[model samples]
Structures are given as structure tokens and as C-alpha cells.
Target: MKESEKHISHFDIVVIGGGASGMMAAGTAAARGKRVCIVEKNNELGKKLKITGGGRCNITNATYDIHALLSMYGKAHKFLYTPFSLFGVNDTFRFFEERGLPLVVEAGNRAFPHTHNAHDVFRVLEKYCIDNGVVVMLDAPVERMVMCRTKARIDAIETSKGSITARAYIFATGGASHPETGSTGDAFHWLKDMGHTVTPPSPNIVPLRTAESWVHTLSGVSVDSMKITFLVDGVKKFHKTGKILFTHFGLSGPLILNSAHTIADMLHEGVVTASVDVVPHLAHGDLDKHIQEIFSEHKNKNFKNVAEYIAPHGMAVSLMMMPGMPLSDTKVHSITKEERKHIVHTLKDMRCTITGLMGMDKAVVSDGGVPLGDIDLKTMRSRLVDNLYITGDLLHINRPSGGYSLQLCWTTGWIAGSCAE
Candidate 1:
């Protein structure tokens, strides 16, 4: 028998795209004694999962209150009540813990494996599918979805390997974020062809590319705590306080990534700029006194030499390079009170202009897929196609980082797997 006939021709359920939701759906269906198969394009499953949260795998947001948890999903929060009801945050905790993968909640109520390794998260999901006897088909990319001749039902999927037929189908192929991980939004096109409205995808949870060359110099520096204020054409719009990592390309870390979409909207208004307050906790008077003391202590030294004593580590040089700021080479003893005040202001309001959001290639999550109205949220089934279910990023839901995306996957996948016939 060829690769096409390697497994049984028919399965109780066929799940496409073996990432977080696909694996969860397949395992859940198999646990119900249904024959399930997950067709993955990549040779290994969980390609995206292994790299989430910078390889730590933020498993889920541990916000157990259903209403509060759903609110993180933005406008789609209302549509998620049914699916989340089936498998809420507490159920996620119980499911993984029952499977021997104890999760620990960190700051921001984000949950992770005890080992803090994404591979460990993948291991648990992979084992869940294996223990439930779900068939795993690797390197089998589905080319298209075939429909039954007389009805609006998915009959079978034509894959690179062969044809796969199932009574019920689940499309968890994900959105166009991190294409290298194999989630290239292939299912969106198929869903559109099948008569489902697919919202065009855009990178929502991604980093901001900046117009400043100085930001590039401070590449790997991460400020543990700082206040960043967003300004549109010099008018202050909003501000956030958190950790931020400066990248060669731009700004990242949880704070910047979560703020990218909002900044993207601000870009449409006018010139977007951000002011980074290096010492947010300290008042200007206190900071000036502290800096004056530092200057007094190093009176004989050049300002550049003692710059690190003032600003956050690795940020002093870049902060000094800000336009209209004092010269770094000036002797501390000779520096005027006004120049010192300028240094304090520059440190407190370090500026960088926002260019735009990073492309889908660097996106943590992309929004845009089948709208919630097209699906029966309670069953995770397509209202248009009776036997087809949707899960994960394939649904257009805008959510910030900090494990909310993975939580959506787990909730929808479990519900679809359990309810699909």
C-alpha cells in the first residue's frame, strides 16, 4: 500500500494543522473513542508551540473568572462564552495537571510548565494524542477541502500525501503569523472557497519598527521597569508602564508587543512617537538630586565616562545620543546647571518615533479569519458547513500576549473535539 493507504480511509474526525489546537482537538476526539487523525504539514508537530513565549510556552492565562478572562479577547469576548464554558481556565489547569504536567502561574497570571520549557508543553500535548490513540500524519499538507456533491459538508481533504475522509473535520491551521512555523493561513482560503467569510489577516501582536537609528545601537538592552508614553504628532495619547526590550529592528518585550496594534492605529493618525521614562518611579526633583550627587561625586570625570551611573544599564550612551541633548564628552565640573537639567529631561523622556508594526513573520499572533457569526460557538461547528469545525487563530479574535492566545486554542479545541460528530 502507498502512503495514501497507510492509514484507514475513514476516520470519525479529521483535524488539520497539528499545532496547539489541532493536537488538542484530535486528542479530545480520540479520548471519546472516536477514530481521529491530525494531518500536519511539518515533519514534527508543534512548530509554533515550541517557540511561543521565547521557548517558555505561556500555556494559558490563569484568569479563572469566565467574564474577566473573556474580556481579554476584545470584541470577540461575547462570542466565546459558550466554548469557554465547556473548557475554562480551571479545566485547562485540571487537564494538564491530570496529565502530569503541572503548570505554574507567573506575573500577569500567565501559566507555564513547571520546567519553563516550550518543548515540555509540546511533549504533554503530543503524549495526549498518543495516549488517546489519535493517528498522526506528518508532512501531509492538505491542498484543499473537498465538499460533498449534494450538501455543504466537507467530504474529504486532498493532501500532499493522499486523500483523507472523515465524518467530521476540524480546521485548526492557524493564521498567517510565523510562516516559518508552517501556519501560513492556508485554511482561510479554503474556508472562503467553502463559503465562510474570512477576514483578511494582519499582524496584531507584533513588535513596533522605529524610525530612530539610535534605537538600533541599544539592540539587546532590556529595561526591567519603565514608563512609555505614546504621542501622536507631539500630542500625548496614552502611556504604559512595564518591561521593554530594545531590538536592532525596533522595540519588543511584553509591553511593546501588546501595544503594537494600538500603535499601528495611531500611525494612521499622524507621526507616532514614544517617550521612554527611564526612572518612572522617581520624581524629576528626586532624579535631579540623585544625578547631581552622581555628578558631584565624579566631578573630575567626563560626563560620558559617568553616564552609566545615571541611566539604566546599556542605555546611557543611546540616551545621550538623543537629538538636542548635551554633549557626552563635557567635563562634569564644567557642565552648567541647565545642561545637567537637560540630561535629566532626556533620561526622563527619551524619544523614538514609531515607523510601523513588524510583518507577520515576527508576529506572535495575527488576527483575521472566519468571523464568529459564521460558526456555532457552542459546538465549534460551522453553521454553513454542518460537519466542519474551526479552532485557534483561524477565527478572527484580537487578543494581547500573556497566554490569552493559547487559552483560546485550548478552549475552542476541547469544545470542538467533544461536540463534533
Candidate 2:
């Protein structure tokens, strides 16, 4: 049978996954006069994008230097130089702003809509796709790819609904993170079967569950300007100072999530421990002196009464219950010098045993997919499959939360769409 007769559906470009990259790729390709069709497993497009940045949709970071921006991905930094240079963060701002969506930079160079609604970001992409004549197949899961061995290319994609044929294909099905959004690592298996070197996917930007149950009581309380350090086998691997929230499971927020990638690896090796410096800016000796002053001033008051001034609301109550701390009924002046030191140590280095990471269902972005060496960074096209392209979390790039992940989608999707023949 002829190539055209064997395939069920035909298009100039077929994008699997109606996510940030898939939608962007389809829209960009269709805008350039290519017949485009997007196959998405989810009923709605940009489901994960809609909930990002706490529903504000952190659009992109405002880092102008390509090197500085790439540095956020660590080892994956080198592979991103070409893609960022082609469609950097600045280009992303221009791309969205030009389409009538102006972005506002929030704390830490994170960009979001002025209205602070993630749905608006999705709306723009939806409009762009519709305006450019891109066909969207919602609720369609791609089951496998039909490779043309003679041409050494991906000739067609088989989905739960049916098969789709295209001259070129882009896979932006995302990773195993946020399973409710339909990202379940299905694309990884399909690509692995096609002879691509696939990295085992794991939860990256996810919350860490601790062995201590006291952390649950501290849920909803966030520590600002705090420092969190991840130590692997007694060696500190990574540390970052920012804000983190106490969760029912353990720790979360910006700092904890960013450190989750390294923590997950440590947990796999054996056991990982995290130390939180609530008062990172204060020196240990200085904090000790300060506490002495507080003790002297509140000598007549109960130990618990003095806690309110020294710690943030609710923290004092939790701290008093920590190991070796005397009851709240004890007089502040009655506390011993050694006890004071213990209190200071507890405040400075609140230790938590990291048992494991939350599942992909809670991860912001998953780590694992097509290995970096398997794709051409310049065009984001697969080195093994001539007509295939990869983008977004589907690539094995570890990036901190902000707008880095979405910016990646924009950069890779744009390059892949433009380069697709």
C-alpha cells in the first residue's frame, strides 16, 4: 500500500500533547501556513499551565542573559544554550505581549499576568491556536508511534481514538508529574520502544514528606528568608535561602520544591536529612545573645509568654513542645544556660528527616524523558528519529520553579515548530 493510503489521518504537522509546548508548536506551525493537528489526552488544554504559580501562571522569568537563565537547570544548562539563544526569556515576553497579553514581573523575577489569573494565559494560547487554524483533538491519548524504517522517520502516531499521520511530529506530552492533568509518562514508554535512550522519570519539583509528625501541626505557617539545606550521606549537596511552608506531609513552598530534585536522589540512595535555618541571617552567637536579652527582659513572665516576642505567631507554641524544652509554665529566668543554647540550636537548625518525596500527582514538573544527548539542542529535533521533536518536561532538564519550565516550553516548542519541515 502507498504511504498516503496506509495512514488514516494526514497533516503537515502533528503535535502530540495539547500542553504549553504542543499548543504553542501547533499554533506557530499553523500560523506559518502549515496544516497542523494537536492530539491531547486531556479534555482541556493547558490544565497544568492553568494551575501553575498558584493559579497566577508564572509566565516566564525576566533573566536577559542566556547563560544566567540556562544556569538554573544545572547539568542541563549546556544543552539549553542553543534553544535559549533562539527563543530566550525576552522573546517570550515579546511573544505574549504582542498577542495582547501583558506580563508583570513578581518577586524573584517571576512573571505573571497583571490580573494574576492562569486562565488568561491559557486563553491566549487557545485563541492563538484557533486563530491559526490548528485542529485540537481533546481527550485523545497517543498510544504508540508508527515508524517508517525505510525513511528512518516517524510516519504516524496511534492514539486511543485513532491513528494520525504527518510529515513531521512533535511530542510535548510532558512527564509523569501532575497525573490529574494527564501527564503519566506515557510518551516516555512510546519513545523508549522507538529505540531512544529514555531517562527513568521521577518527581522533581514536589513536596518532601518528613518522618516527623510535628510538622503537620505547623502546616500553613511559612518561614520567609529561611534557609533549607539538603545533606546526602552527611555531605551537604544543595542549599538555598528563600521561603518555605510547613505542610501536613512535611515541607513545601519555593525553596523546598526547588531542593526536591536533589532530595529525591538522596532518599533513593538511603536517607536524606534537611536542616532549616529559620533565622538564616542571624549568627548563632548573635542569636544567643539576643535570646539572653529576651530572657532577662521577660524574667518575671512564663517561658511561653516570652516566646511570642522571640518567634513568629504559632511557632513559639510548636517550639516549646520540641524535645528537651521545659513546659510553658516555667519561668523565663529559671531556664538554664545549657537549655538556652539548646533552644537557640533548635531555632537555628530545625532538623527534619526526609522520608521520601510526594508522588507525581503533586509534582510541579517531573524529571526524566528523552536524554539530553538524544536530541539536537539547536532545533530540538530527535537525533534518532528524523521527523520527531521533543519539548517541555518531556526532556530531562531540572529547573527551579518560577517561570523556567514554561519558558523552556516556549523556547523548545517555537524552535521545533519553526524547524519542522
Candidate 3:
């Protein structure tokens, strides 16, 4: 087929989804002498990326060991090793730093620009694309992909604005998380229709809503270094130790979001229960002894007055309301051993009912997309379609926060763009 006859709005590459990966792929391809165009549904590019890491944009983790980095991901760890080996953390660090965006590694090795602005990350990519002659079609949503069966290639992509044709196509539309940011699982449906296996998308790094009403009162209270354990069918299946934030609805933060996946799985099968060890560092016996000592020392004082030192600030009042303790009438000297045990148990195991997940609107990342087995990891090119490639959260790769997701985007985007020819 003639080059002019085969295309409508012709380019060397047409990248669908103007997200992190899409921008990266377009810029990289354009840099490599490939004419590139990006079709973005939103009026602005990198809307989601702009707000990532609470607007700081956790660029990448500082870890260089491929094995240790792979271990961060659950089952998807093995699939990512090949890609990481090609363009791992070191490449990600250099990619930004070389572009005048120096990165700083924080407490958990989470890398962010020295300015800590997500806009800077976007600026670097935007500047790179413009400098390399990449065309960006803003407010253009890809309606459908037209594939030529005889050639087994994507001939053209129909967008809301118009049609564009290219020799190669890259999908980096992200996942269903933060639909307000324009990610609504459109890529998954598009890929599924094109004969690729797409996993059912679910809320991954999202908050969990609890059934308890009192939890709402504790909104904005963050517990650091707490161990959260998820129970399925009365069996403790998942557990993680980190920081968690109590919201008006329930719980969130790094630990809670990661545990939500396990909780969702258990909830699908049956009922699930969640327990938080607020003072995980303290042994039960040690905690009990500590409480006993506090009570003995404050024997002459009122029970309510002594409770403040043992529990978290503002939590003592809530604990005093539970079963035995009478905040108004009981004195520390009159408090029985049984009541003290209850307080100790409450302090150790603060239980909450797992009502439901917060949904994609609040998710940090969504879990579901084109199955990994359906795409070639080396090139990020589709196994079914000859010229079609997938990248970012659109590919089913389970990962946690702290810059792993963005790194995946960078690696896969670079690979897809490099292989576009």
C-alpha cells in the first residue's frame, strides 16, 4: 500500500492517551527521528500526573538493585524484571536529571524533584515534546481504532476531533483510577475489542470505607508505623506495617491502599475483617505491664485523668466510653484489673468493619487492563496487532505507590517508542 493511501493524518507514530506514558513515548519517538502525534481527551496534558504524589510527583525510587526493586511488586514482579533491566531506576533518575530536573531521595527512597513540584516533571516532558517536533492534539479522544486485517496492523485511529493514521500506535491511557482526570478504563475496552485479554479492573490503591460511625470523628488522624492485618474467612491472609490515615469515611494512606486489594478479594469471596495494631512495636505483655505501672502511679487520681498518657491524644475519651470505664464516676484507685485488660486489648487491636472500597475516583492506581501475556514485554508491542503497542497502567501490572507506577510508565513508554519503527 502507498504511504499516502494508507494514512489519513499521517505520522510515523500516533500515541493514544496523552498521559505520562503517552507523553514520554511521543517525546522519545520524536527525539529518535520519528514523527509523533499525541491524542489527549482532556484539554490539558498530564492532568493526573500533575496531582500525583500530592502534587510533588514521586518520580522514581532510588533503588538500583533490580531484584530488590522487583520484590516491591507482588506477582507482577517477575514480568517487570526484563523491562527494568533495560530502563530501570538509574535510567529514570538520569532521564529527569539530564533534563535539568534534579531529584532528591526522601526518607523511604522515594525520589522527587528538588523543587518537589509535579509541574516541573510535566514541564520537562512538555518541553521535550515541543523541542523534538511532536504534535499534541488536545481535547481529542480516540473513539475507535481501525485495524487492517490483511496487513495485521492498526491503519488509523478515529478520535473525537478527527482521524489520524500512522505506522505505529501506542496506548498509554492509564487505568480506571481518577476518572475525573480522564482515566475511565477506555483503553481496556478498546484493547479487549481488538482481541486482547483484559482483566476486570478493580480498585487497587484506594481507601476503604468502614461501617463504624465513630471512625468519621477520627478523620485526619494519622497513625504511624501501624500493622494492618486483613482477615478472610477468619484467616489472616494479608498484613502490612506502615502509616495509615483515618478519613471521614474510613482509612487511607500507603498501608491502607495496599491492603484494600486483599480486602476486596476477600470481600468478593465472602466477608472480611480488618484490625489495626496501633502500637505494633509494643508486645501485649509489655503493654499490659506499662498500663499497670501507669495506673499504680496514678492510683490517687481519677481514672479519666490517667487514661490520657496511655492512649493516643483524643483517643482516651473514646476508649473510656467503651464497656467498663465510666469517665464521669470512676476513680483510678477503684478501677479493677478486668477493666485494665479491656483497655490494653483496645489499645493493641483496634478493629473496624470492612464495609466497602472508596471506588476508582479515589484510587491512586487501578488494577486491571490488557493482560501481560497478551503483549511482548521487550517492546511493549501487542502480540495480536502487529503495529500496536501498550504502556503504563493500561497493562496489567500490579504495583505499589512510592514511584513504582511512574517508573513503569517511563520504562514501557521508552520501550514502545523505541520499537515504533
Residue pairs in clash, model 3: none
The full ranking of all candidates by lDDT, starting with the best, is: 1, 2, 3
lDDT of 1 by residue, 1-421 (tens): 6755743478999999899999999999999999999999999999999998889999999998899988898889989888888899998899888988899999999999998999988988999999999999999999977799999999888888778899999999999999999999999888988899988899988989998988889999999999999999999999999999999998988899989878888999999999999899888999999999998999989878888999898987897787766577788999889888888888888889998999999999887888999999988999999899999999999899989999989999998999999
Q: What is the lDDT of residue 175 in candidate 1?
A: 93
* Candidate 2 TM-score versus the reference: 0.93
Worst 10 residues of 1 by lDDT: 1-10
Off by over 4 Å in 3: 1-8, 296-302
Better candidate by TM-score, 1 or 2:
1
What C-alpha lDDT values do all the predictions have?
A: 0.91, 0.86, 0.86
Which pairs, if any, clash in model 1?
none
Candidate 1's TM-score: 0.96
Indicate which candidate wins on lDDT. Answer: 1
Candidate 3 lDDT, tens digit per residue, 225-283?
A: 88888887677887888888888999888878777777777788777777777778888
lDDT of 3 at 56: 97
- Measured against the true structure, the TM-scores of the candidates, in listed sequence, are 0.96, 0.93, 0.94
Top TM-score: which candidate number? 1
From the highest TM-score down, the ranking of the candidates is 1, 3, 2
